[model samples]
Target: MTTVELQRDLPADPERVWRALTDPAELAAWYWPERMAPAVECDPVVGGAWRIASAPDGTAVGGRFLAVARPLSLSWTWRWDGEEHESVVAVTLAPTAPELDTPDGTRLHLLHDGLRPEDVGSHREGWVSCLDRLPAHLGADGSERA
Candidate 1:
């Protein structure tokens, strides 16, 4: 098994970013590849179930929450819609250094572990695409609606 790890500094505080990760409405805004409507639903609690799937049951990605530390960390099991491979994904958030940020921000770290060797690249690309769109959902002033 291999792991995919990524870190990105977001222009919003951990609290705002955390909403984007756990809120069903927020997740739908920027949790998917560009040009695809995301159907996301999550309970944001330990033992709760969450899913991000292509609209109308196209291609689903879902899992049960393993850990749900609000505004800080989240971990869950991951499985694709019709695939047999299963993996674990964990995300951590923290404040970025003052020197490295302007109006305070979150340093987001993600880890996807236990992937089959063959699935690494696509997962990496998918995550990159998702993260790239995250900032847009977080308003420039950080005061935008959740």
Candidate 2:
């Protein structure tokens, strides 16, 4: 199995980044731009389920929460529409140091494991696109959008 590992130092704080991950509205804002309007159901608790379905593309992504630690880390199972196997996604957030610049910033680390090697490229692109929009959705103050 292959793993897709990505680390991004975001302009927002850890709390704001956490909200973007678990909040339905915040997710809809940046998850998939292809979805004009997304139907999102997110329950950020252990054993909880989360799903996001898009309209035009008719694509859906879902999974169950395996672990949840608010404002810090979370892990879940991930399976996309028409996909047979499910991957494990683990995310960790930490505060950026004063030296790295962006004083009130967050270092977001995401790990998606259990993927076939053929699936890595697409998964990497998908995640990169989604994460690129996260900063904008985090808002200027970081908390307002939460």
Candidate 3:
């Protein structure tokens, strides 16, 4: 199986970052395509169901939460609308160094595993765009000065 991994540092604390990931409202604000009217439902607990409406189609895509460790990590199954196969996504958050020039923030590590080789590139691009939007959602812009 192919895997996609991404890491990003944001000028926000772990708790704030955790909320952004687990909270449906926060997710709706930045998770979906910009042109789409965001619609999301998330149950932030292990085994809970989550769903997000896809752009232009309004079809929902989601799965159950596999793991939920508040302010630290989360893992879930992912399946798009009409797709039978499922992939897995895991996110881990940790505190960044305060001693560094950057302000105290959280480091986010994301792993998307169990993808078909052909799906890897698209998933990677989608994830990169999503991650790039995260810091702006947090009002940090991924900067130390934020």
Candidate 4:
């Protein structure tokens, strides 16, 4: 199995970043908006169940929250139907020290592991595209448009 990783530095606080990642309303502004359901439920706790279906109509976006560390980290199971594949997605938000290039912001790191090598590119593209929109979504004058 191979792993796909993506990292992005957003111009937002960890709390705001956390909201973008975990809050349903915020999620709709970016990540998979076309497929994000009304967030039937979210517990954000270890061993808690998490599920989000697609839009236009409901479609299973299989997964469950595995661990949570508030605005720091979250891990979950990931799988797409019509494919006998399962993987783990872990996201970590680390605050960057004050610097010329990087101010008080969080470095968002994401890893998708346990995927067959052939699936890496697709997953990589997905994450790359997703992260590309993140900064804009969280920017000073940004708004969710995904």
Candidate 5:
């Protein structure tokens, strides 16, 4: 299995980043496509089923929360039913200290694990696209690392 970790320094605060990650509206603003549902409905608690459906075509992504540490960390099962694909996505938000070299902002660490070699390219591309849109969606120009 292959794993990919992506990191980004967002200009927004931890709470804002958390909201963007968890809140339906904020999440759609960045992560969801225009035709997709504007709001995501899911019980974020551990073992709770989480589902995100896209509009127009109605393609959906399904998963379950494996862990939650509100505003800090969230680990969940991720799957794409149309493609019959599954993986684990763990996200962490951390506050970095003020420094000249370091970007002063919230750090978003994403770990996408258990991907097959053939699926790696697609998964990486999807994440790259997602992160590319996050800055404008959050109203902040942040730097992302893949």
Candidate 6:
């Protein structure tokens, strides 16, 4: 299986970043494509379930949390609305060092595994776009956090 890994540095603390990652309302704001109001339900606990309905096509994706480490890491099993095959998604957050551009920011790392090689490019693009919007969702002004 192919694994898609992405890393991003955001101008926000780990707590803010974690909320943007796990909160359903915050996810609905930027997780899907722009202008699409996807319905989201997130149960932020180990073994808790979550689902996201695509507004554009009405496709539903559901998963169960495999691990939950608040403000630090989360992992879950991922599958489409009707698909049987499952993949895994894990997110890790860490504090940025003072030498980095966003010194007090958070470093976000995402790993999506068990995907078909052909699906990697599209998933990567989608994730990159979503993650790029996270800072704005966190009320960032594109400047270093004080």
Local error of candidate 4 at residue 127 (angstroms): 0.4
On TM-score, the stronger of 3 and 6 is 6
RMSD per model, one decimal: 2.6, 2.4, 2.4, 3.8, 4.1, 2.0
RMSD versus native structure for model 2? 2.4
50-118 per-residue lDDT for model 3 (tens digits): 999966766778999999989899999999888998999999999989785447789899999999999
Clashing pairs in 3: none
- 24-141 per-residue lDDT for model 2 (tens digits): 9878878878445788999999999999998877789999999999899999999997989999999999988867856678999999999999999999998998888877777744
TM, every model: 0.91, 0.92, 0.91, 0.82, 0.83, 0.92
Off by over 4 Å in 3: 140-145
Q: What is the number of backbone collisions in each predicted candidate, taken in the order shown? A: 0, 0, 0, 2, 1, 0
Kindly list the per-residue Cα lDDT of model 1 for residues 24-138, writing each as its tens digit: 9888878886457887889878889999878644788898999988889999999998887889999999988778853588899999999999899999998998899898888
Lowest-scoring 10 consecutive residues by lDDT in candidate 5?
A: 137-146
Off by more than 4 A, model 6: 140-146
TM-score of 1: 0.91
Candidate 3 vs. true structure, TM-score: 0.91
Clashing pairs in 4: 35-54, 35-55
Cα deviation at 46, candidate 4, in Å, is 1.6
Q: Report model 4's TM-score to 2 decimal places.
A: 0.82
| Model 1 regions more than 4 Å off | 140-146
Candidate 5, 52-112: lDDT as tens digits: 7776766778789999998889999988766766889999998766772335567789999
CA lDDT, candidate 2, residue 114? 97
lDDT of 4 by residue, 25-101 (tens): 66666776444444434557787766655655655555778889999999988877455677999999998777725
What is the lDDT of every predicted structure here? 0.87, 0.87, 0.87, 0.76, 0.78, 0.87
Task: Select the stronger candidate by lDDT from 3 and 5.
Answer: 3
